[model samples]
Target: MPRYSDADLLEEIRRVADVADTDSAPSLQNFRDHSDIADTTVLRRFDSWNAAVVKAGFEPNDPQQRIPTEDLIAELQRLREAVGHAPTIDEMIEQGNHWPSTYKRRFGSWAEALDAAFDDINGEAVFESRAETEPDDPGTPGPHVSGETLLEDLRALADELGEPPRFKEMVEHGDHRARTHTKRYGSWAEALEAAGLDPDARSGGTQQVSTDQLLADLRRLRDELGRVPTATDVVEEGTHGIATYQRRFGSWSDAVEEAFEESDA
Candidate 1:
């Protein structure tokens, strides 16, 4: 194998850190496995794997940094401005300055952190906004929609689209905002499950299929169709569905190629 440059190693570390679970601190083994860079190389390059991770924009693996609540709120606002909308948990985890789990821990949940951020941005308390926007009757559904109602809306939207909408699609076209569902049900996938749909099929929450299972499904589709399976075909016919394959392998074409390679082997 060729020797990796320092810049190349750092870039790979950042790539791995970007997708790793935010709930846990990243390790040398994580960098090694995800980047194909040996742990010895990382340690030799930066004196420690944590040093390399720090250069990659991840929080240091020392005593967990206690981000001030005000700073967390500001980071949320910054993300909202950058994205032109309220940031989702996944968005925050992927793009925000702080970890999504940190925000959740500081505010008791991601929804509450968002509420605080929104309130700070609008210069009012959450209840004040509720008072201004909500109807007189507590029973009436308004901006602060209940979890059950949000689930119903999700089902209705799915029915309209013939499949569950991704988070961006739901934000652009659905009746309720994505933030509303997250606030009510903890995450969109949770809301989706509450609505009696496959959560993995809709939101890219957790991987519902292993790599072996996804490859098997892809091969099965190929055998049945006698050709490569498109994303639509996976959505309509595959066992774990299109979202599962997409999450596992990045895209339909990638999944098809992987399946073919496995079959050839």
Candidate 2:
């Protein structure tokens, strides 16, 4: 390779740090796996690999500090619940305690990590067990709705709930079953998009979210906490992401005030 500079080496370390899935700090081996530049080059300029890592602003990696497989899965499930969908790498970073890299390290890959989580979540056979209990087509007898009608219902539900509809929300509150949506659009996220709604990506700043929804979720958090909730409470345990509230209401304080003001009213 052409002669690399110290800046190049350190930057590569930071680059790997940003994208590497592990929550633990990047190690020299991680650098090797990702970089075209040599580790020896990193070592030649710096006293030690970690010395360079510090310069790049990464904490030293601790191989011993491993998160339990079960904990990782549990956090993934929590993330899914919080966001109302499968957890993504970015979601994991934002809400999950463990890093995606930690899952990759523990489960051999992020895909496998998600599979293990999905299996564990669905009790080892999400489809098989649900199939045993529920009918193949849960698109059961309801007022027949065309795709256009479904979109109308979805938009209507968003207006009613003050947020975009989730799969469960649609099943419970809208005129159609969740199955009908997936049948029409192949996924709930797509269904929301087809309805001209965002998939809570306030997660999809895109979080199902509106002032009323945020207030309800905050009230739920308050009941759980049994005290006034802080922003940390909302982020750590509330139904909606804290950022969603901020985006919707201009501040976490404003969101909480709205929730409580409604209760007092």
Candidate 3:
């Protein structure tokens, strides 16, 4: 028998090893069945199947296993170079078609598939904004207007008006600007604050939720529910199930307390 050379047998073994998944290993029996190499020649090189697999460039249990796709591409590219030929776009397309299936099997969705394919071709995926994102919602307006312009405008308006015009006089005379400010702010105190006045400094008093009142409310809720109220319950009841609760009371304690309050009530 014209026995196959060691180099040819090794190359064939490497090709099979390349296609096998991380969980699989190549065997001498498979080689005998698939290739024209004789068992006698294969036995001469490898003492065992494990030895043959190791020779074909793989550890028995490598955690960081690489996919054979790139290696296969590299081999094909090398062959093309040897024959003075360049792979065409159609050939690349045919090859690229395998990427989605390969990616989906590894990752579980189309988005993940695209991400993996992106990594293979370009080392990283480009960011894709969701279709629902609104283009016109620029954050917080212009810094010039947002931070300083409003204050500047208020200061300018105050300077132009001068000496804090009497709101009672304006209301009696039905001054349009005074009427507009009163309508928007509800009172002179609110209007003064909007124009950047320190009402507390002038009045010298403090306003706060009394601890006794808070305790009374909590006790009432707990008694009604036969349990303590949660933050979520308080927020939901207080805010009428508005999403504002999530913003204010972000802890489990708050939700529990609110829940208890509602239950007790």
User: lDDT tens string, model 3, 158-232?
Assistant: 455453333433334321333233223323333445567432222222343333434454555567666675532
TM for candidate 2 is 0.28
CA lDDT, every prediction?
0.61, 0.62, 0.39
Structural RMSD, model 3: 28.2
| lDDT (Cα) of model 3 | 0.39
Off-target runs (Cα >4 Å) in candidate 3 are: 1-3, 18-23, 60-265
* Alpha-carbon TM-score of each model against the true structure: 0.37, 0.28, 0.20
**Of 1 and 3, the candidate ranking higher by lDDT:** 1
Ranking by TM-score: 1, 2, 3
Model 1 superposed RMSD (Cα): 12.9
Cα distance off (Å), candidate 2, residue 171: 6.7
What would you estimate as the lDDT of candidate 1?
A: 0.61
Provide the lDDT at 92 for model 1.
58
lDDT of residue 147 for candidate 1:
57
- Highest TM-score model number: 1
Candidate 1 per-residue lDDT over residues 63-151, each given as its tens digit: 23545677888988898898676665545543556656566567777667777778544323443454455433322234334557677
* Residue 15 displacement (Å), model 2: 21
